[model samples]
Target: MTLHPQSRSERDPETHRAISYRTTGSGHGAIVRLMSPSDLGHLIKPFVFLDLFEGESSFIKGMPMHPHSGIATVTVITEGNLRFEDADSGTGMIDYGGVEWMRAGGGVWHGKEMSPGTSKRIQGFQLWIALPPALENASVDSQYLESGAMPEAGPARVILGAYQGVQSPVRAPDGMNYLLVTLRAGESWSYVPPKDHESLWLSVSRGTLAAPGLVDAGEMAIFEPGNDAVTLTALQQDAVFVIGSATPHPYELALGNYSVHTNPQALRAGEEKIAEIGVRLREYLRQPNDSASVPVFR
Candidate 1:
């Protein structure tokens, strides 16, 4: 099952390509970095920002209240629980290795606080998936799924996407899926995309994964649209990654503090809804990231 044994295409490079990550915010309590989706835009159709967060709480406790709209955010906790509450959604906690998906279709107010009385190190990823024009104005909804509830096939954990004849419990819009994969040392796995799938991208979270050449942690490996199944081998005791997507939902993305959409008009509309939600609930909105801020991409 070693990737080394497979006959790699003559035009392909022999090394696993590293995905560049730009450090955004880091302190004693946490490290925040923006994984460059724009650089690998062609390989990753609609998904963006494989944001990685580590360390402790920096806020008076942790991240305060926030608002969102027009996109779905998938939060996977691997090490510590994340305490969250909203004016209407009620309060809840997502434990270690848990996954919480928030679809801010039209608007929503959400907040995350650290587990009370504990300064546990929280490690997780927030994957941003753009909604199609149709769902862009849909109602907002949130689903919290425990880690054990996610489907697992062999060494991989089916987070939200499908792989190897196994599908995730948390179905996504437009046939898209995102999966968390972990391989024991010396173990290997292979998966074929659904017949209509248009692309596949793999991002290693920890340890070394062999795909023709070894791809270490923090790197992204992309595959061209083809009929062949992808094969990956673990070179270390534990290799974890996020493998996902189904149909290619490619679109021109305009990223703002609280929204990921196709145009400025859409972003403006999203913000208006977010404001309306906050005002209706008597809650204050977190300032949106300045649209004029410098780009983090190279």
Candidate 2:
């Protein structure tokens, strides 16, 4: 994901500093790459890539199988629904507030895991977090969580980390937090980062938000490092968004078309594992029932 810089002439009243990114896409679907490992992602590590996507259910189903390594992907649906299938979890429906977590530790092949639900159109975001050195080459794991299974605090749902004493069930690593929030029009909320959680950013999925500067829908804002609480006011009815905070990742990022690792050696290992899994995935798909568990690297 390439990030073209936007003018930063405005500042949030509370913090008195702000950085913003505008949504850019091909226009075929309302798809946007809000952050990437190269740009804002360098500043906000652990939380690496973020893609905001919405389209007809039929179109989404056409997505081809892809592979990833050295990262964990979080798929959150905000509108419509999707069918999630795996050998371990079987099949489940993911609607609003539902989550699909895939830890492509060493390697994994996916894309056929999700299909259109009952809705005609679907909207959602997929986020990638770079795994730490200890787990970057671990085996793959997955989970499908319904809305009722996720815990909420006030207007925010604890998606990845703890918030206000409520912990998410995602089994994510420590030192990072992700939340999905909805604020009624004219309402306000404040987020105070935990100690050492110096990296903070948010992207709005609908309506407008005022973090001092008015951030319209489809925009993302990165806050300056500080302990100052960030305040946001909804400029329209039911503004929905996701925010993330984390401790800076300590290792350098070794990039690949479909993988991210902490070093060249790890990158090579992950890609080699991916090649080994690809053959198995193809064979599994040829079976009639095709209920085999996704290959996991040990």
Candidate 1 has which clashing residue pairs, if any? 29-56, 161-177, 161-178
Candidate 2: the clashing residue pairs are none
lDDT, residue 11, candidate 2: 44
lDDT of 1: 0.62
lDDT of 2 by residue, 204-242 (tens): 888989887777777777777655678889985779899
Scored by lDDT, model 2 comes in at 0.81
* CA lDDT scores, all candidates in order: 0.62, 0.81
RMSD for each model, in Å, please? Answer: 7.9, 2.6
What is the C-alpha lDDT profile of model 1 across 1-298, one tens digit per residue?
A: 0021124453346433222221222223453444444544435556765666666644325455577766888887655666654434455666555677777776666654224214456666777777877776578767777676777777767777666677776646856767777788998887666767766667676788777566777555556565456678889578877777567766777666777776677878888888777675453223454442211110
* The candidate that achieves the highest TM-score relative to the unseen native structure: 2
> Could you tell me every candidate's TM-score relative to the true structure?
0.75, 0.91
